[model samples]
Target: MIILASASPRRQELLSLICDDFSVEPADIDETIENEIELEKMPEYLAVKKAKHIQGNKHFDDIVIGCDTGVFLDGIMLGKPSSESNAAEMLRNLSGRKHKVITGCALLYKDRCISFSQTTEVEFFELTDMEIEDYIATGEPMDKAGAYGIQGKGTALVKGIVGDFYNVVGLPVAMLNKKLKEIISNAEKKL
Candidate 1:
């Protein structure tokens, strides 16, 4: 059995593409980044933390997957927007420039854990304030990292992507499939 250690509907939706038998077991992990931690390490670190939190529980022996995603613009990490204006600001900052979407995934079962990070470079068309404001008005950008959802209406703002599109959507499906197969193989070996 597989368990997902996250509350994100996006992560749940992405995981559903892989298997339908899995269960959701959202973990309560600390999301605060360490003051000394580098920006690039945030996703992996958080992913591990979330996975460990779930693995620490004694009730379940299933493989648990945890993931964290963030959007980086000019070296700053943009989380979910706090308000419509903030979402507008995030969209404006991403306008006509390339930004990175980083998502880290972790798989854990018992004491063994594996983690990997995927980075996707996304280019955005130059967006006017009206466009940004209009996007914010839809209420879609408020809950997404970098104030955009590549798989939804937010696609209108993106010009192109240079890496895995699934990563921008919240999971790196190709890399995840490879890693998940390896983990399952190892677990079978132990059995």
Candidate 2:
């Protein structure tokens, strides 16, 4: 059986494109990023933690996937907003600038694990305060990293993207599909 360790609907939806048969098992773990973790490695660190947390004894024979995404602007990570005002501030900071969206993914089975991170460069149009306020009013940015959902109403905020569009949505479907294929192939070979 294949299991996904995430509560984000976007990740679940993206995973479905790779495999139709799977279960959602959101991992329960502390998500706080420690000061010692490099900003670029934060996603992968959290992702491994989540996947490991879900891959306990019961799921020893099953494959578990965990993913963590973050938006980085000028070296600082902009996580999910704490409030509507914080969302606005995030949007303002991203205005007319290029930022990176990185999603770290880990796949675990038994004692084996595979992990990788995908980065997408997204540029936003110069946003006015009114536009930021309006987008925040839609309430789509509250739960999304960087206070924007590139796949939803927030699409209007993006000017262009240089990498996998799906990566910005929370998962890199193509890369994930490739990784899943490798794991399944090796497992079958062992059998």
Candidate 3:
């Protein structure tokens, strides 16, 4: 069985694009440690941590997948907003700027873990204060990293993205699809 270590609906939706046999078992971990890791390494590190946390209880035959995402501007990582004004501030910081969205994925099977991160360059259209506030009113940015959801109304805020569009949504489907195929092939060879 494939187990997803997340509570994100976006991740569930993205994972469904590649695999149908799976269940969610949201991992409980203190994300505060992520604040200490280097910006570029934080996502993958957290993904591995989450997967490892859940794999401890799963059967050896079960494959556990965990993922983490973040929005980076300049050199600082922008995580989920804590409040309405925080969300607006993040949006203002991203406005007219090309920021990076990184989604890290980890797959744990048996005693082995494979992890990687996908980075997508996202350019935000110049937004006015009213635009940011109005979007915040809809309450979409509060739970999303970087205070925006590229898959929803936040789509209007993006000018264009340079990598996998799904990465911004939460998961990188193309890379995951390829990785899944590789794993299946390896398993068949072992058989």
Candidate 4:
């Protein structure tokens, strides 16, 4: 069995593609970035924190997976927009520019763990204020990192992506599928 330490529908849906024996238990770890940590390392830090937080109080021995996703433009992290206005601002900042979407994942099974992060470069076409406002009105950016969901209404805001599309959607399926296979195969050896 596997346990996903997040309530994100995107993550839940992604993990579902791999296994049906997992349960959702969103971790309550503080997501604030450390003052001294580099921007590029924040995602990995949060992923590990979330995984360990849930792993520490385990009442069962199922494998646990924790993940975090963030968008960075010119080194500044764009977290989930706090409001419609904030979503517009984030989209405006990303207009006609390229940003990096990074997702970090951790897999824990008892005393064993594996963690990794993947980054995808996304380019947005020049968006007018009307376009941003219109996109925001669609109500798609509220729950997504970088104020957009590549797999939904937010696709109109993106011009192109230079890396894994699934990463932008919150999970790198190709990479995650490989890791999950490894975990399951190893777990079988101990069975």
Candidate 5:
């Protein structure tokens, strides 16, 4: 069985494009970014951690997938907003600036584990305070990293993007499908 260690509806929707049969078993683990982890690698580290937490010897024969995403601007990582004000601050900081959206993914099957991250450069149009306030009121940015959802109403805030569009939505479907196919092919060869 394929098990996805996430409860995100967006992730679930994306993963369905790669695999038809799978189960959602959101991993329960501390997501705090450790100081030891480099800013660029934090997402991958968290993804691996979450996947390992869910594997735990119980899903030895199953393919377990975990993912984590973060938005980086000016060398700092912007995670999910804690409140509306925080979201507004993030939007203001991102106004007319370019940032990166990185999604780290992990796939585990028995002793084999594969992990990777995809980065997308996104540029936001110069935003006014009123625009930021209006977007925040939509409530879409509250639960999203970088205080914006590229796939939702927040699209109006972006000027351009250079990379996998799906990555910004929280998953890199093409890369993930490729990695999953490779793992499944190798597993079949061994059998």
Candidate 6:
């Protein structure tokens, strides 16, 4: 059985584009970036942590997938905002600038694990304070990295992206699909 170790509806929706057969098993862990992990490596670190956290309780053959995403600019990580004001500030900083959306994905089965991170460079049109305030008022930026959801109402804010568009959405479906195929092929060979 395949399981998703996340509570994100966006991730579940995104995963559907690649595979429909899976279960949700949200992992509760300290998602804070550790001092030892570099800013660019936080997503992969957290993703593996989340998967391993879930792995302890599942069947050996049950594969669990975990993912984490963050926005990075100038080597600093932009996490989910703490309040409306914070969201506004994040949006302001991203205005008319290019930032990276990094998503780390990990798949665990038995004692084996495979993990990778994908990054998509996204640019935003210069946003006015009124526009940022209006977006925040809609309550769409409250729980998203970079205070924007490129796949939702936030799409209006984005000018363009230079990598896998799905990576900005949350998961890199193309890469995930390819990885799963490899796992399945290897499993078949073993049998």
Which structure among the candidates has the greatest TM-score?
5
The TM-scores of all predictions, comma-separated, are: 0.95, 0.97, 0.94, 0.94, 0.98, 0.96
lDDT of each: 0.88, 0.93, 0.89, 0.88, 0.95, 0.90
Candidate 5 residue 133 C-alpha distance from true site, Å: 0.5
Instruction: Give a tens-digit lDDT track for model 2, residues 97-123.
Output: 999999999999888899999999999
Per-residue lDDT for 51-158 in model 5, tens only? Answer: 998899488898899999999999999999999999999999999999999999999998899999999999999999999999999999999999999999999999
lDDT of 2 at 42: 98
**Candidate 1 stretches greater than 4 Å from native:** none
Summarize candidate 1's per-residue lDDT along 10-58 as a digit string, tens digits: 8788888877788888888669888887998799889988888887785
Stretches of candidate 6 above 4 Å error? none
Name the best candidate (by lDDT): 5
Stronger candidate by TM-score (2 vs 5): 5
Better lDDT candidate (2, 6): 2
Candidate 3 at residue 99, lDDT? 96
Tens digits of lDDT, candidate 6, 16-52: 8888798999999988667899888899999999999
Candidates ranked, most accurate by TM-score first: 5, 2, 6, 1, 3, 4
Estimate the lDDT of model 1: 0.88
* Model 5 poorest ten-residue lDDT run: 53-62
Q: Mind sharing the TM-score for model 1? A: 0.95
State the TM-score for model 3.
0.94
- Give per-residue lDDT, candidate 2, residue 127: 99
Residues 1-191 of candidate 3 have per-residue lDDT tens digits of 78899999989998998898899999899876645678878888999889888988754567788899989998999999999989989999999999999999988877677788999999999999999989999999999999999999999999999999999998999997887676666656766
The total of clashing pairs for model 2 equals 0
Note the residue pairs that clash in candidate 4.
Answer: none
